[model samples]
Target: MTLGRTSTVPLADLVRRPELGLVVLAGADRLDRPIRWAHVSELRDPVPYLLGGELLLTAGVNFPEDVDGYVRGLVAAGVQALGFGVTPVYDEVPASLVDACVRQGLPLVALPATTPFLAVSQAVGVALAAAEHAELRWLSEAQAALTRAALRPNPLPTLVTALADLSDWWCALLDDAVVAKAGIEEIDPVVVHMARRLRAVSGRRSGSTEVGSWHVVGYPVAAARVLVVGAARPFSVADRAVIAVALALLALADRSDGRSVTKMLLGDDPHEGYRVVRGQRKARGDAEIDLGTGLVDADGDRMRAIVTTVPDVVAAQTAGWLLAVSSPVGVGDLPSADREAARMLERAVAAGRPVTVDDGVSGLVDPEAAARFAATVLAPLATRPELVETLRIWLACNGNWDRTAAELGVHRNSVRHRIGVVARELGVDLADTQRRMELWFALRWSD
Candidate 1:
């Protein structure tokens, strides 16, 4: 029932049609209001079925005794204008109905005896069809303009500007350290708060919140990146469709840029495989020299390099640089490799040596595989958080009852009871070293 802006026909235009023989009886200044549809209802109270922007045609067959209340109800239901058809029951609009409509500022149109209600309905339908066709053309042009903007050298700013113009709202792209904005110099603090909340919940793709007179909507485009738009009114169907297109374009632009960097840093053939090398250095120069590439990215005090292979000798000989090498992985798996490399780098810094994914005791570096395995093994205690925590603590303490009890602030007997329960639930022998090792690996990998 929601009509697009371009699909709406003004009441004044409908009344101007000569064949309808329509006469404006009241609220002449309100004739420009948009009419979405025409409905002929004889029911005394049909407000529940109306969705606004309606030109309700009634012949006064079941006219309500409380004329003022009836006109007020129509106005409240968002009926654009009331059309009184001249039927045998009421040859003309009643004086009471006219007075009520005039008081309520609801437009009233009188239909002649010669003009069938069907004629007015057909007129409105034809206007709507024409408007819809025009709207489609405009949308197509706007999409083309946005697409062109996305292909520019620096597309982020261009995209923001184009989206702002298209939506008639302020648009911003928020990253961790920088914000790109258009149609506004400074972002409202309320919008910034909403963006932060949206980022905290990663699984949410899009959301809307109200700030004063503005309605803010945010959509996640990448990890730690969001596109936000603020407007005075709620977004219509056309606006949302355009936003979806913009999101897709933005994602493509980001990936395209990232792929170029990946090729330049690693190699032209990414699928051939690569290893992410990380080093702790105050400056990025030393790590870049050791890694044989100036394409190293500095994250705070750590430098990361994506290369075809690991330089073990350089890693071992470097003085202040602690190094870690990820297991060989294709370009598509680089995100996983980057995460594993970060963990390995932490362990290397702790042990004062280079570490690799294989250095771990378990072959569960692949996060998805590890999660599935853990879920399968721990299915019995999945719904029992306290029991899961007790088992994990007991495992961490090397299955020592006294240590686990001290860590958990519980009695030794309680630890013993929980361990017994876990053993029974898992159907495993905690006394066997091999079974204990397997469980320990599952716990570590799952974390």
Candidate 2:
């Protein structure tokens, strides 16, 4: 069973045990309250000697003069429930005590003549210990999960999501700004303010608080940054320990050197699929794409990068900067991926939109042999840019004279003349369907 952090045993756990034979006499509705511990007390006023949430057991040997005031004091001390031993106190629960308990909404349990007070205490102690052990096991699993999450390509989001799942609550990160989160859309403003305040301090600071319905913890993991995690209930000892492990992991994550991380991501685990991205810096922006220089290599007006998968956009697009992504490849073949991305970039520039390489006739044959075939067929028009472009546009238009002419921004007669010249120069028949298809494949590879 999936168990969360628990420090106390619920009163209902003991009441439902058939062996205990404990009967709820008054305030039965309050049995769900948490019991910190079970204590046997007979003094008239035990409030000063007691802590909250204890099952205060009594035989009423030294009964108080004022029963109503006594019950009120117990309630004020936050007693989980009052247990009265029947024979030792009276034949049954005293009417005065029961009436006072019912009036003040204090749960009163009748300990039968058979069950000793020590047995009830022992049951509670065992339950509390079992809960503690289960929580420790849960915490150990949580720490391992966080470590695995830190190994992901996008660790911040992955780690945040893991923490949320572990605590059954929401988590967010603040890096001079609220950067990432999971399991929630909005956090309490008070919690956020506290986190931001924690960020301004130094010396590995951390804090927690009760805000409205939430219990929030702020971990100042990095300089000017904080990781804020919260749940509806108070955090237990084990829960706080798990949070501490997360903070240390995040600190290491912040200390990650970009260059080394990029290197680690690239060559290691190469057999698994990886993609290369090519971006042509056509426009300038305040933000430049920086997945790190090792991952992204800049050459002239273009840059190439390797990633685990494609993203919607590479950081900031910088406006009109074209991007083309290559098909997946491994480490040994990674160098060739740059060339593939370059070809895709040319295609993107031609189509005026982003382009990604996909399986076509190119996949049917060895790429080197296909390139040789394209080079041989289009060798005649290698020096002739006009014929190559005209053929490309004409074929794209499905041999429509007017459409190709409009797209090429040239007259139909000029387009026709250029096609005839291309046919003659390449020594191919334009009317043959097979010939056109072969030439189309060749031209695509040439581009």
Candidate 3:
């Protein structure tokens, strides 16, 4: 197990500090071990007072008879290194202590008489705080980079690049094979097999192993999709956190990331009929949502997808979304189905609930009476042909200013202005769901 946090300075850090004048005399190769703290202990047996990972400093005030036994005890107590101070008790580090440390593989450092043990302790504390601060700053910046990558046009590839850039490690997204990768040109066969093995096993979300000096790890993010990353060194806690964030974002945007609607529709069989769904977020902006395993394309408040099964309207509403689902149609009819979903979304938004295109309420009512009532309610919009057409198109688009504008080949500001005019002319607050529902019905019956 590791001794301390990544923020804790290693034994080597103390020796490199010019002010400390500390020199490594034994176990030089093991200086990378982290020092949790530094303390002066002149007792012959300081192991009993240790809680592990300490750089125990002493001036040989009370030398142990058995130096080998003392070094072994410190090792058992998890003392990372021993620092000898040249003072009244000794002009230099004892040859016996140095030999015992080398034989036991315990790190040893010699402190000059000019440098007090207290200064070494203070320096260790200051270095630890600085390292911790640097790690936190790095974590925050790395998370921000991932967020920005997620918003890109091709999020999956961009995310892979971001992970590679931040970690300086090879990152790849794997399905049956590598879907996207960075930091390496070709993937090792062993890495691919490990990813597949992880997918085959049940309840195995993540696993890691060492291969030929490379530390490789894999995590299952979605159905049949795995994110694999490799580096020369093992991953730290912060590194894992950044990868988790990327995996979660990738999972939510899986089928649709850099993929097209056609691929989603033909996922299983080309002959299979599919439904087009549109959803409007109750509260807009970024939030995680499950849109099913289909070709999903989400742009802020509006989301579109081609799904095999009909969506659960109640579930969508419960999840804070107003959903609209179209009737199942073949691949050739997807275009028409999307328009149907768009129109359904308009009603769902106005009614402040979920709506299905197949829910035809017009036939239930008397057509003549409904038409008469519709004409009376819509008479104000009918006098101007543009307003009548605009109202119809606008209602078919769920009051989305941008979409309404795009359909009418007008600017979004123009669409907003026209909607304001209709609201004022009818003397009703468009913000009211009941008013919008009434207007939707009037437009529906008029058509």
TM-score against native, each model = 0.54, 0.59, 0.54
- lDDT score at residue 239, model 1, on the 0-100 scale: 73
Which parts of model 1 have CA positions greater than 4 angstroms off? 1-7, 16-21, 48-51, 87-91, 176-178, 261-447
lDDT of the candidates, in the order given: 0.78, 0.79, 0.81
**Local accuracy of candidate 1 as per-residue lDDT tens digits, 1-447:** 223244788898888888788999998998888898899998888898899989999898888898988888888998989999877789788999999999999999999889888999999999898878767776786688778667554667778788888756889998663457888788777777777777888685687888788888999886577899887678877777788888888877777766755664567664567788877763345222346443467566677877776676354436557777888887778889888888777656544566666566443244456567777888898887788899889988888889999999999999888888899999999989998887776776556
Q: How far is candidate 1 from the true structure (C-alpha RMSD, Å)?
A: 20.0
Candidate 3 residue runs with Cα over 4 Å from true position: 1-5, 28-30, 202-204, 256-447
Error of 3 at 81 (Å): 2.0
- Reference-based lDDT, residue 245, model 3: 89
lDDT of model 1, residue 379: 85
- Scored against the true structure, residue 370 in model 2 reaches a CA lDDT of 61
Flag the better candidate by lDDT, 1 or 3.
3
Residue 98 local lDDT, model 3: 94
* Clashing pairs in model 2, backbone N/Cα/C closer than 3 A: none
lDDT of 1: 0.78
Model 3, 114-232: lDDT tens digits are 99999999999998888888888888888888876776556788788988888658989988877899999988888888888888988756888777998999998786888998887
Backbone clash tally for model 1? 0
